[model samples]
Target: MKPAHSEFPAPPAQLDHDNCRGVASILSRVGDKWSVLVIMMLFNGPKRFNEIKRLIGSISQRMLTLTLRGLERDGLVTRTVFPTIPPRVDYELTDLGRGLSKPVIALGTWAMDHMEQIEAARAHFDQRNDTA
Candidate 1:
């Protein structure tokens, strides 16, 4: 008797388990509120620590430091130092970070355009679930 064969095809080896982890790292980099704002401000070229804080309006020093450190760790932002009477540091986007601006702006615009519809859908879904 002949044995039956399976019909499903296997996936390419390129679809590796690490893909999700890599995506998660990217999302995590751009996903935080401070990270998004910091990158946006860098769109105007490099800025000193206090200058960024002034433009962002109310970000605390600690939070800004943490966010900048994280961005630096991700290789998206660079920190520069100058030797003078007082040390100075400035932050600017790396090529990769600059490339991210278009995507981030697109996402922000989409959210603004569709937020009302999305909220309405969420309310309707919540009401239906409550009635059920």
Candidate 2:
């Protein structure tokens, strides 16, 4: 049994070419694993490029650079250059980027809270399929 709203519409939500393409484009960018992590890291405050890499640990230098560039292009992150002995650069979230943080943090919290349940469900599904 399902509530009225729980059931999908007859044809489901619109999946016209333009709609699908637009959604996929954005999802491909922000929905990437590294993008999410990078966005989360910048939520605290502006961080140097190296600082972000060190904190995120597993991400490679190339990937981080790409992520930052993409975010900057999307107008979600601002890159600042400080004139000093050598040079210094920092990345901070823009207003739009900060707006993105709220939902991302909520999602991260939900994943942490439900991890055990998700793992249990995975195990159950695997066992059932194994026996089939």
Candidate 3:
């Protein structure tokens, strides 16, 4: 007799067009350079807006604001405001955001480990393309 697992056909690996578009949109949000950096910075703990900006060092205030807003909208981040003379605001990863950390970190680790190979591949491709 066939195995029980063989009773069902294997699922398609590729998403249908509509599903693909939806996934692509989410990937674009998460895969953007600034989002990755922001997420990584928050992985340590909560941080104020300026702290995130200072650590990232090159993002504009507008861009940072947009990024944080997007993350908060997506339910990946939480923003808290404190009562004070000037008021203090902080951003932290929510459970959903923390869930994203592992995959993001793995992507970063893989990039770091293979960057040399990627650069070599790029150089080889460029040299070949230049000859052509």
Candidate 4:
């Protein structure tokens, strides 16, 4: 009997033009630095706009607004507004976004673990190239 994982399609060896374009489009969204940071910020739980901005530290107000809107448009996040004396808003990951967190977190951990090795490799490569 085939393994359970066999039910899923294997990674494409070569993507056709349309498939390549689709992959690039999605990567341009989720692979962006700000989007990755925003997704990480929302991974824990809901947070307000200013709170997300504060946590990310260097993102401008306008840029944060745009990032949230893009994530929401992609169905990866949801925005909620509370009716209070002064209105309050919260941003949270959707089910899809939550599903994405596992891989994102794993990738982050892998990067942290391998950072020193990666830097050493880069330095070695640069030294070789510089002296060539």
Q: Give TM per candidate.
A: 0.75, 0.87, 0.86, 0.86
Candidate 2 residues lying further than 4 Å off, grouped into runs, are: 4-15
Q: How many Å off is the CA of 112 in candidate 2?
A: 0.6
Q: Estimate, for each residue in 51-114, the C-alpha lDDT of model 3 and write its tens digit.
A: 9999999999999999999999988899999999799999999999999987898898899999
| Tens digits of per-residue lDDT for model 4, 1-132 | 956697667999987999989989988888787888899999989999999999999999999999999999999999999999699999999999998878778878889999999999999999999999
**Clash pairs for candidate 3:** none
Kindly list the per-residue Cα lDDT of model 2 for residues 1-132, writing each as its tens digit.
956774545654667999889878988888888888989999999999999999999999999999999999988899999998688999999999999989888888899999999999999999999999
What are the runs in model 1 whose C-alpha is more than 4 Å off?
1-13, 130-132
List runs of model 3 lying over 4 Å from the truth.
1-14
Error of 3 at 34 (Å): 0.7
Top TM-score prediction, candidate number: 2
TM-score of 3: 0.86
TM-score winner between 2 and 4, please give it.
2
RMSD of each: 8.0, 3.2, 5.2, 4.2
Query: Each prediction's Cα lDDT score?
Result: 0.88, 0.92, 0.94, 0.92
Best by lDDT: 3
